[model samples]
Target chain A: MVKKKFAETPNFTIRKDFRPLDVKEKGLVFVGYEISDDKKTMNQFLHYDQLYTIRHGWNSPFFIGLLEGKIMGTRCPKCGDTWVPPRTHCWNLDCNLQRTEWIEMPKKAKVHTWTVAGWSGRSSLKRLPIILVYGVIEGSKTAIANELHGVNPWDVEFNMPLKVVFKPKEQRIGAITDWHFEPADEWEPSPMNKEKERIKKLVEPVYEWVKTLK
Target chain B: MSRKVCIIGGATTPFDYGPTGFESIEGGAAECVREVMRDIPDFNLRDIDMMIYSHFSVHFGHQLSAEWIIHDHLGLVGVPHYRVENGGNTGGSALYAAALAVKSGQHDVVGVIGWETMDSVSQSQGSEFIALASDIRYELMVGGIYPIYYAAMANKWMRENKVTEEDVALIAVKNRNNAMDNPKAQWYRNEHRYITVDDVLNSRLISYPIKKYDCCLMTRGVAFLLVTTEEYAKKVNPDHYVTIDGMGLSSCTIRAGDRLNFPGWIERYGPGYPEMTEFAACRQSAEVAYKQAGIDNPLKQIDFGEIHDAFSTSEAQIYKALGLADSENIAQFIRDKETYLEGSIPMNPGGGLMGYGHPVGATGLMSAIEAYYQLAGLIPKKHLSSKTQVPDPHTGIVNSHAGTGTSISNFILRRV
Candidate 1:
């Protein structure tokens, strides 16, 4: 199998300055510089940077399946239990570390829970007011969290039917982000309620705030 | 046979210490030790047989093995020490470790010191760092920060239990209002001491249903508690000590999805058991603690509580898990003012995490200290304000939780 190239490594620089040691004693070195304006209340910054290569190990199949437009989960053969975001082994005490086998899950799912996230970590800020849901995919015993598109933040409801939409195979990488959920074609949002209006009002300011961030 | 343990005394740096609180982590820790020593008469650093330190994340301070520096700074260079880290339950876990040492006759006196320096990074970056606590491969990849996770739970919980946005906002208002009486509360440092449900509703939206006011502050502070054997407690400040009667620690799956349709959970807890909406770990921990403390009904037996209200929604769900209110009547429980200062079960009288500020590592110890003060009848003395003091309280519960109720440590303290 050919090694798939990921994104380019971003270039960055670290600021550093050297100064004579203030201590009278010898054999001492300073690695941090004061950043505070007040001399009495000294604050210093020490630069830290590193790159990590994490392994999926036994969970690699789950990510690989995402790239192939398949939702793969694990099943405890002994107990006939299935899981999405596949577990390497059954967590049940009765199963006692029983290794699970991979099983293909259906694209359809039900929204077990959801949130219209107005803010997010720095990387995903551009996707503000995004609807995230923990959906129990068909044939899987556990739910998997992912972004839900094709619905307004206020229109989301409990037990909403959804179907997974995978990225085009050419654009797919072996990651959970390879696919996202969209409202099933047959479903329609209910008429807005007082609660939905309240949420809509609450989320309006978030869009304005996110604009300022840009 | 095990010996009983007691919290003789403790002290904490103001929760709103902010970015420039101290020059270094060691300085902040030493100050806490000094303050604690000064608070307890006849107690000195030399009397501490062992020490346990709680610090949540090394990412914030950019330092590892910080307990070693803290121990050396406190002039405890030769003392045996251990460090405990359990996301947000760091402080409670450290206290539990120290109490076990005293109870099992391993040590006569154990000191629990905890601190967190979160001001080292910007608020956005801090959220990113905290989001890393979630399952990086799955949850974190989808931008699962705490507010989003809690908001999802809040959404489901509110829908299932008929809890409205106003009901959740009431908790924010109450806790922030309660903070006015706590000199060390972060709210005391802010310009706005009083807030209403409308104010909470108007705050900036963090995640849908979770506004800025609903969240706890990122704090930098230190706290230390001294745990001693029952006999040693009598020799020390016996008149002002609270016994550690019962403790319970429990954990659940780090991924919220695992809790859904968990095998045997429904059979054990009935329908909706182990639902992602409620904290099963919290309920389990409370049950263990109540069983040990001989508490049949927490609402009737416990006088007050110091809850880990990372978000207003969490506090309401915790009240149900702690059995302070029934699940069906939770919204009514809050509407009836059952958790107010003058109510039957006053909670977070010293301003919980939402008001007190959560320094992660020190938050649980702060709760424990608040419980200690309440049971020892020193709230007015310690807080310098009598407004939050429970009326002659005899029993109190201190709860410290992490993740979406992934790890929980609960303690039941009683006046001896």
Candidate 2:
């Protein structure tokens, strides 16, 4: 066979190795790899930028409220049920649903449950043995799972009063991390709202289809 | 208008923790398929009319289009082949698809393979690869690794049920002991096969409430299954004992918060808490499977069980969700060893994910394989091992779940 100036299979013929310079930008992952000219040797390095913007959509206002040091919610005009995550739609399955009205939520809530993690992942591991509490946001059926800080681990109890503490202005951002919960001495107890609309039945065909699956 | 589906034969490679020594995905898959073929006398690749491969991550093995790679390696060029990726339950989901293929009458015989090679990379990389299955926008962005999510669920379950670390430790101990009888299981040869509650409680914690032993080992392996029609099965193996009677697959909302709103749920643990074990998907899938199998009560109807014990806590949660045990007393079931091989309904006779090892994509079919062995009376003759085998298993249920209960598939098999 005649030697050609260029081979048809580019991957088969490894060229000179190329080195990738590090990029310092946040939220971008860069992976580097090199193969020898003989296509016999290879090395690779994976670089990850863990931060990224998560679109909150209709829930953006909820995060935005934290930046303003105000807890916000959306009340269903139809059934008076409120969601602290600030949903655009009503939870009420009945009645002609309308756009929910944005309402400022009470800063105080009660811890429904909590866990003291002796371990965590990359983002939270730095604060090892972090305490996470699932709190029922006061005056709303919505509950938020957030970091419970500034409280003794042994002192934490179910249904204990917790108060949301927004980060300072310099630290504030439109994210779930902009606030954390702390033990609160005084907060009003909200009236028990009618059991937030229970999804009594699954969507048709799904429930019907489950039993008839091939 | 579906035809009856039967499992003619199946095989699973011994699940090994890393450095599997397989060069390519095709190599492991082809070897697994060959092993399955060996189980069915006179069977060959040509008998398969179609193939379905289940694999969750192409990143782990640095391989893509796995079905094509597998089919080419098997030398089944003309075989209609495709791949299914459903997180951890990929195996069972693909098998369900294979059953549908046979039931559709388009093909009487189909091959299903679940293969994953995570040993190609480091353990941390494996964790990251699996975490990709979670909701990237919410769960993954918020410091969520697999163990943290499961730990959070365990925290809620333990708090609500008044269960302690020692109470849940029995699950890990039972499954590990059972693995001693299974040569194919991961810890079958370990000197610490029988870990005590103290061992688990004192072990290094991955995420609080989940110890090292509570989690399934990061393993690499492949499992294969051959599904054929009822008539076709009879012709091939007149004495074949197990036939897949019913299969149910259901998915809940990917967001943990939304999962709590699944129909008729009591959100005792608040948002994201119920998703851990009370996966509406599992309940829905079990309901469908039980109804189709004519099972009124799984606790009594199921002779044995093979559950997705990705974590010991998950198995306990599944036990309650499946109605295999009551919610308030799940710890008692474990404490009493009620689900042990010699218990009322022996579960994970072959050690389950905890013992058999979890190769993600392959774990579901591994459950299927264990259930098949139980229904077919293939217990190996070892005292402690045979005890894990139920006395006479005629009906069984194998549960498969993925991504913190995002996807669930249940298979109901009977020794007909």
Candidate 3:
């Protein structure tokens, strides 16, 4: 086919109903179309588009940790403040220049606040009733908003204990949705096991830690 | 005591999706300029020293140099044109820029216009575009949408205070009814003017505790305001003008979590609570503005307010933040109708962003234009839809915000 200057791409005026004629044969992306109320003229635009990629520097550990079935946040060594969905530096000005240390959050968390989303934006339409909940990780100082799953909406309550349920290893991706939360049953901690668990927690960093070399 | 700035005249298109000429957004811009010129005799493109245009999410229009497009469409090619964008607060920011231009004496008269074209795409696409204003990495990535975030904030406020869904619904009802009188309002023509609290309560849920009616609609419209030096105002209409008495701007952390200072509720829910000081942007802005205007008390000194009611719950929070009411008495302050037009201090008499329609970029300018009408006492009888109007209002405030209480820009307008 001979490439025509400005003639290769054909433009079609929209009909009164605001529907476009078959342009699939032209191999053009249907960008957008608009119609006037008087129906005198209808305009449509089509063109080549670009998909941009997002880079997560200094925050890759948070995403990588998700794929590893771990929830993580950054801890300010100076202020002893914990941030989920981690940051690279301390939020407080007083703790200036204090590089944040990474810590894997506890699997156990509680619903701090929540909302049942019946509608969502274009990106998450298929994930309706998003059951978005701001959860307070058991050992963290802050709450992180994430999807809550594996329970009826009406059963959810404030301060309800929940456990993280990770996606299967093969299907796991380094994203926030890699794991969701479910209700946790009450545990009557036996006195003997409680002491051992406490000792183990103290010996460990309480959360997995990672750092970047300067 | 810098040079004073006054709004000589303004115009706004009736909030609508479409029915324009081939120019699309440029057509709306032309209409605004034409109408404002018609409103002010002898006013033309030649008098404008500078132009400030407010537009959010340029991708929605699929155009660049939008400010120039509007400027050139008005036949002012060489005129200095600048674009001011700060999410939903774009309009307010543009107005502030215009005021600064006149105050600096760099421009004797400036034209500020705010226009948005969300209707150019589908509603879902529009929502997607708006969601970009939020913390995309954290919020949007996990399926968090714009209205859902507002809904969560509403839930937090209700849980902290003993506010009921009914109270929030009352705000929607009042604003929807108020829109009935505002001929330019988006909901004015619809039967929604008679929407009851139950109607809002029973409406389809967009997010829990926040029904569809509780949220503002994504509208497409344009609003323009002309700010000129006091001397220029005298040249135009000496006796009739609204001077920008005071202005204030402030911003806060993007993370909503950082702003919650509610210890009582956070302890109970294992989460942070909504603290008055946490949402300090608006309060700080209102305080600086009132102080600059030489007003000691805003609740008592200001006659009316055209606040940013992007969501119903935001109105209540703003009331507390602006010192319109104390934490203990805020619910009563709103519930008692003190903010009604007939009450002590009228709020959003023209329905606000809720009833008036929030075309993002145009909302802040819409508030200022509404205040201009109230301060000038020129609000057409037909457009005066509030249950009551502040009698002979001398001063009013226009509150504008970006994200969920992110950036705050306010201007106190007084009849000169």
Candidate 4:
């Protein structure tokens, strides 16, 4: 009981009339931590994603331009630079101006970087495959994330020419990417693998932490 | 131009999650400004000097590439303005930037407004998107989400200090009750009546130690603050005011993934380590504000105010960091209800981010505005009319955290 409580939320000490170290066997390699209610410890694990907790911005395109396969980052008038995912101010450290004009992101660009994801179970996606990437676009200060189709994750070469493809409007989820990435070639787009993303999201973290245990 | 600035006026709209957008945040900005104008009756919006517009979800609003969409809609077009984004800290950073603008003598009257609409995005994607704000190269790129970070922090706190998971729950119960008096709060009256420590310990795991009650609900809203100089304060009403006493902003590494001593919430207590995004942020930011206000003992000196209690774990760290209660002994403070709005140092009179809503972009200024009203005794009857009401809580401070280990600011407001 004494040890498990401590393991649950580690770092700060509470003042207690009964010190945990006083009565327990101190040196059994966390014999103290295992003192918590073993059956109940697992019960404390929570699912914050569900039961309506925190959520962020939508993914679908806000304007017609994005739905029509346009890169629509904002452009600041004071700096007169075009922001691909448009911005209200010049993010330039020195120039501080709001009120930007919307501009089209240059479609013709090379792949800056890429990651392949195998699907995990979630809404509409069941072990589906997907590719996520970021790169320099013409006239944009920041790189944006988009879905990559048609090419294998291993085949995703750097600086390769690619064009944006809007997802079917019915498939939109109000996210930044109502559209995803597609090879400039009109060949069949790959159905994203969700397994890789699942491993990245679920397994990698505990795996890394456990390595330090020994 | 000394290294100091003053708030001239401020504004906000009723907060909700996602149902509101940039237009609504803009609308809140408009309403808050209109309220400020009504209160001042002298300074006109057109007469204000410059502006900084902040929004964390402009992309979701589909207004990402066009800040002008809201900038122009807000009617402050031709003067001077820029959009600001620092993930979650954009709101406070906006005020911090506005303060810099004032001290630099760049803008005489600056309107700093932040807004967000989260429902605009689907939930699963929201987690990944927010996760992106961390050191994505290392943190998000690997798959750690926000609560995981907090869970890591909670893990650290429990390990170092002889504390229990129930301690984290106590914070949630206390904060939600605090939200009851807050008309603008989102989770003011939770359905789970009379939650207990055992209940918290048995709840579903969100990265562990972070139960459902321990986390905050999502909501939409906008907040605005107008700031100027002490001289300018005399021009705006002079009496019902709160000066920017000692404002300090800093950013730190929020990812525990990087530190061997990641559990060092107690160990990493140091100077010049600015705003902290972790639960520790409230404490660090409070330390700066307390020092600036010449407050040697925050619990005894500074009056009650609001903070970014985005998670119950965060409030635990804030209370401990602020010295309102020792980390281990925090559960007692909740029983005393000393941190509530009607308690010894009424906290979250506006219900905080947990109750009111966590709009990310507008949070900082809203915390400041709540402090402003508390100090000015300008609280509405709803917050004051409750069984929990102790009437006016004057002279307070507002502290909030932003982004992946980005910036935190502490503002002290006093009734003039």
Candidate 5:
């Protein structure tokens, strides 16, 4: 009879010997999700210079006007509603809201609510410094999420007065460029959001824990 | 417990695993059924009475593959045919279902068939498809693979007492060597000896504790059995017959995610997770089998047998669950070569799903076939290097479990 091998390969083997290992006691699931160490065999590695064409239209001055500290938005002459960040089309389904106006307005709004992430992979924000906020401008509001700087993440409250703060270009990524909400130092927050009770009951504890990283 | 059902007739196609370029699943199933029909000159195809088909990947023919296509393929069109899908346990469940129908007097004779094809579809997809047997919300959604299913057993089994991955590897090596004697097995790829524990440790990781080698390969093939009463058996095959002596089915947690924690599950099932536990879906089938057969102490009373070694861990647990391993010296049992074809209780003598090529429906029936052979002394004894071989003592059993956690069927086949 020919000697056939059914279970012997470096990558795929079944041990016949009766020795043991202490792997299972560690409480770690045997398979790792991420390939932990770079086991690439060949030496060439990847290069980055081949892709820069998409970065050219990045920071035009018209886009920089908001960073220059003046109020900015896209205005509709018909409904008198101010839209910022200038979307190309209107969301008004009733009257065909389209991108038809460019206008300027005040930069202030009131904070509706916030949350701070308690955990992170990096030693970031000193203490959980990220904040998610719902801000209302003249007649309209949109929820914007960003990291809170300078102030404590846990101290943020609903209905606190706020203004947009844009970081310097040298430290920013070109996409979703720097712009976050900051609270006015003296204005205390009013508990007025619609889901304020549930929000307070659920989210604030996490927010407080996050503030300690700083 | 109820009276045992017997296999009057059975058939097989050349073990087609679809992508293996053998016959397709339906073609293989039809061939097996046709072979059975040929053996039983008096039995009529239209009078199949009821139908139970098993499948790993129905691909498109899930229910209709064995039922619709098989009916058309074998020329038995109008009878009701239902497909059984339970991952690796389907074959065992298929046989159990057919047995139950025969015992219930639902039909004079029922055909149980199963098949699987892994070469055409990607292994990950095939596995992901079977992973559906686990709870979607918690365990699977968390990216747990099949080996992890048994790895948890390996972990707890080790913590509670002592069983290592190497012990599992020893079982794997044994199964592979056993498959060498079986031309019907799926592990024709390599010799199991000479492999070391370090090899299993270094294999590609799928889930912690489960490496690529620690898992079974997905093969393509079809297998089936015909179940009926003693009267029907006498009518179909008057000369050859094997009765269900001590069958047992136990349920385990089908989906592990729903429970508050995992340990709550083992409390009901005992050693082999849900397969032996009251929580398992196949509990009724097992109870009826053990009671009808009058087997109160399975470990001591029953002799050599086969089981659902979907993973090597399962084999170990069943060793204890059935009370065979003696617990005090299980390692000595394996190292001394006790659990082999000549061991005190030889399990999965057909190579098990680990090496037999787990093609769903065919696995359980295949185990049944092995049981029938062992009962009749058809199997070549322990392969003493191919040329030298001899037979061993009698009394055999085959335990199979499916993915559903509910479909477990343990079969006890004996020679008169």
Candidate 6:
């Protein structure tokens, strides 16, 4: 397969602007400028508006499996260690970077730990009060992180059983968000503890505050 | 054996500079360099044999190869120099590298200059840039910002250790209150010089268990430290210097999830241990440093500590890692005021990252500078106040961590 040139890619774009601003402070200059020998030319801010084209490279199979409604992981042939969010090579010093083989991971997992995020990076700010969890899938030695949904954030619990829920085929983008975790058939949130109650009290107000911003 | 390395002098710009603190990175760095030169007797730029630049991300300033520009501006262009980038550990890692250079006899006197100008972008944009430091493919995709990542650990740790939200808030209160005595602390410039634990509990939530006050300020500032061999240190300032007794650096998996049921968790920490909640790298780093420093009991042997409290939760976790407190006694440790300036094994008397602004590259070096000043008994003279100084401190430890303890460096400094 041939890759498109960056110039021809749909995600590539450039933004340019030039404006003068007041420089009142003796030493605080907004932009750094360099002049030519003849003092004619100068330089200022330049902006690049482009989306990165990051390839999965050796981990392509893992992403490919996501779109196919299956979770893929890597297994070390030498040591029999399994990894989700798969690695191309074994990380163990004993294995010595041996090439790893792909294996289909079980859809079920147990919540190792979690947090209810009231704020996030700019892109995910709108999805406030998001539940993020690190889940250890069955038959895998390591855990993978993803969003947890279908249950109230306050109701999330440790060691909760969960099953992977993939986005519809048309909505799939081969990204990690292509799937998320939801409560398994037999799982239920336990009664709230004092520690969790405190978190709930702190986080509830944030939801209201976020609504005001929106 | 490597030659002994000592920090003879150090200086830092006020952390409240905000973004656009100076005309350029060079301008900010030059100010710090000049301050260090003036602060240390008979010391000047000419004394710096090599320079290690600690800078975190190029995304902030949109500039690459910034170390060269700062190097040229400092009039040390001919000297060997390179930049070190390790997320939040940039400062400590750079200092570690500089110490090695001095210890190996490659350079008798080394300078570690660290700075970050983060106000170039809005807070949200800055958060986005910082989140990119995580494993972008897995963690960042799931909306994992620093606060959220730390909050996850906080939740598990708090529940297991029986630590309350109020207990975590006490850290914010202690650090910020301590900051009032620090002229360079960001909190020192705040309208409200002191905040109560209730205020922290009521503060807006960034992520569950991590409130607004619990977070460190995204700052623009610079810190400089002069590390040299015993000969050079004695030559410059014989009366005021701290010897680098022990330094240890360690790293772990960048992805927090991978630590779950970690390979050696049960063997190392005992059965039924919550692995991801603890900072294993921090413990490993401190273990190495303590061993080398001949410290059998850190809480009793070390006089004080300047910890990497990127979040209040991290500080609590680090207390256990540094052997200051254990899981069962951590909450009680904070409640009993064991971590305050006047307590046994006082922690962060100079205001930690929470109260002191956190300019990623400069933060670790700032902690080292505080350790140096405290050990040398220069707090009252240099900071213009004795409120934040530990009494007759002979040993102090500085910890710098990055990426959810993905990388951690611990240094034990001794009054010489």
Best by DockQ: 6
Report, for all candidates in order, the number of backbone clashes: 0, 0, 4, 87, 37, 0
Q: What would the per-residue lDDT of candidate 4 be over residues B143-236, giving only the tens digit for each residue?
A: 3356655554554455344445666666666666666666666664334244566665555445444555677666567777888877777776
User: Could you give the C-alpha RMSD of every candidate to the true structure, in order shown?
Assistant: 6.6, 11.8, 11.4, 21.3, 21.4, 6.3
Interface RMSD of 1: 1.5
TM-score of chain A of each: 0.80, 0.64, 0.67, 0.53, 0.51, 0.76
Among all candidates shown, the one with the greatest TM-score: 1
Could you tell me how far off, in angstroms, the CA of residue A112 lies in candidate 3 after the best superposition? 2.7
Order by lDDT, highest first: 1, 6, 3, 2, 4, 5
Which of the predicted structures, 3 or 5, would earn the higher lDDT when compared with the native?
Answer: 3
TM-score for each candidate, following the candidate numbering: 0.93, 0.81, 0.85, 0.61, 0.58, 0.91
Candidate 6 vs. true structure, TM-score: 0.91
Q: What digit string (tens of lDDT, one per residue) describes model 2 on residues B313-366?
A: 888888887877766677787788888866898888889888988888888988
Q: What is the C-alpha lDDT of each candidate?
A: 0.85, 0.73, 0.76, 0.59, 0.55, 0.84
Question: How do the residues A53-151 of candidate 5 rate in per-residue lDDT, one tens digit apiece?
Answer: 332122232244544544455555554544443333443443375554555546576653333433222323233324444354433323222334555
Residue B208 Cα positional deviation in candidate 1, in Å, after optimal superposition: 2.0
lDDT (Cα, 0-100) at B250 in candidate 5: 57
DockQ of each: 0.51, 0.12, 0.22, 0.02, 0.02, 0.52
- Model 6, stretches more than 4 Å misplaced? A1-46, A191-197, B17-23, B264-274
What would the per-residue lDDT of candidate 3 be over residues A60-178, giving only the tens digit for each residue? 78887887888888888998778775768876667885899999888998877777776778767656656778777876665677888875444456677888889998677576777
* TM-score comparison, 1 vs 2, better candidate: 1
State residue A45's C-alpha deviation in candidate 5, in Å: 35
After superposition, the stretches of candidate 1 with alpha carbons farther than 4 Å from their true spots are: A1-38, B264-267
Q: How high is the DockQ of candidate 6?
A: 0.52
In angstroms, give how far residue B340 of model 6 lies from its true place: 0.2
